[model samples]
Target: MFECFCCPVCGQALIRESQTLRCSAGHSFDIASGGYVNLWVTNRTHAGDSKGMVTARRRFLDSGAYGFLLNRLCSETAAFLRGRGEKDPLIVDAGCGEGYYTAGIAAYLRRQNIPATVAGVDISKAAVRAGAKRGEEVSLAVASLFKLPLCPASVDIVLSVFAPVCGAECARVLKPGGLLFIVSPGSRHLFGLKEILYDDPYENPPNTYYLPGFRQMRQFSEKREILVRGGQMNDLFAMTPYYWKTPADASARLAHLPTLSTPLDFHVDVYERCEDDAQEPPVCEHQTHNQ
Candidate 1:
């Protein structure tokens, strides 16, 4: 089902050994029994997949708090593929944290009888390992988004849900007519948590960086207010990065929150690669000089 993978470094065929990937260049990466390979070679790992973070993410997702977002993502992705008349789409979730969202989408596709090859890649080995342990049908790999371990123009669709996006790399791996779906938290997402954690939430600014490589095709938003009560509030707090830098009183405040109704705002932006612009010079000239 995952025959499309290749060596991240040499771009050669990756042979699946007992629990590892061996390329023609003798670069071998061990695949955890959970069925995901670790392909990250960088020394600096992002703040992802630590035991506590993974556990928090799993607990929060399993609670069905994010079910609405997952459902919307699955439906939109499926509809997009169906409209394009594409069959057996290859999908990958970049920065797939704990595999909840990836697993959810894969299950949705399977229920619809859509032939698809789903793989979730992350820089966190722990996250991929957890995803692998979840079972088959979804391949998990510890790889960087900046350099995906796949051949050029191989994937049919790419999903980036609350994760980072490397526009150039995504465009390179996607077929000419493929689409990339990005889901990001809107400015108002998690406002309640922000209000409790920081004294000046507005001063920190928000993430509004947009990709420059692809043309925007469609944009839609999904908002749901969840009334998180009891211990689940703590789970919600831990799952978010806001808790990390929060003051000591943040946790206390969360614990005291009898009922927190926060908006879960997510934006789904679909973009198609501009084929004609593929051969054009660098769009960000400053990047060339920095290199």
Candidate 2:
């Protein structure tokens, strides 16, 4: 299922050997018991989301508060894959977090009888471990989006949902005319929750959907209101960027509320990759590391 991983140390293709992925240069990465490989070759092991944050995200997402978003994403993905006319498509979720959307999309495609190879990559080992528990259909890798372990021109579609966009690296990995799907918060997203957290809440600013070596193909927006209890509300807050920056007083407001209704607005933007000879190649070395 995961035949596209490259060596982080030597920039060579990795061949899976039982519980390890080894390269031609003798560099190897061990696959975790949870069925994920740590391709993040760095001294800092705990980089991305913390275990607490992953737990909060998993709980909040599994509560079915974002079921509508998942359904829409599946539908959109199936439609795109059908139009592509590939017998077997390769889909990569650049920052899959805990694999909620990754697993959902894979299952949805299976129901539609579309054969797809899904790969989920995240910088957090904890998040990838949690993602592995979802299923083995998605190949989980603890790798950075900026410098993916994927080979050149091998992927069909790249999905980035509420995650950082890596333009040049995406272009290097995606085949000619490949699609890049970016999902972000739409205007007025989480406004209801914001109202309770702050005295003056502002609507979310417009999102920029531009990326190098890619042209905008389509844009879609969906919104839904969901009621969440205090515990679930806390989970929601903890999973977002606001939790770290919000004042203690603002956070205390949710402690007394029995339930809170919030709007979840998401914008999906599709970009088609274009050939840019001037585009630079992906940087393989992370701060000049040696094998």
Best by lDDT: 2
lDDT of 2 at 243: 86
Per-prediction TM-score, please? 0.88, 0.92
lDDT of 2 by residue, 1-291 (tens): 556778877778899888888998999888888888888887765587999999999999999888888898888779888998887888899889999999999999988899988899998889999999997588889998888999888888998888887777778888888898878888778888889888998887766743667788889888988889868989998887788879998888887899998888887888888876565453332211000
Q: Write the per-residue lDDT of candidate 1 for residues 131-215, one digit (tens) a residue.
A: 7766758978788878888888878788887777777778778887678887777767887677776676652223443455567
Colliding residue pairs in candidate 2: none
* lDDT of each candidate versus the true structure: 0.74, 0.83
Candidate 2 off by > 4 Å: 276-291
CA shift of 276, model 1, Å: 2.2
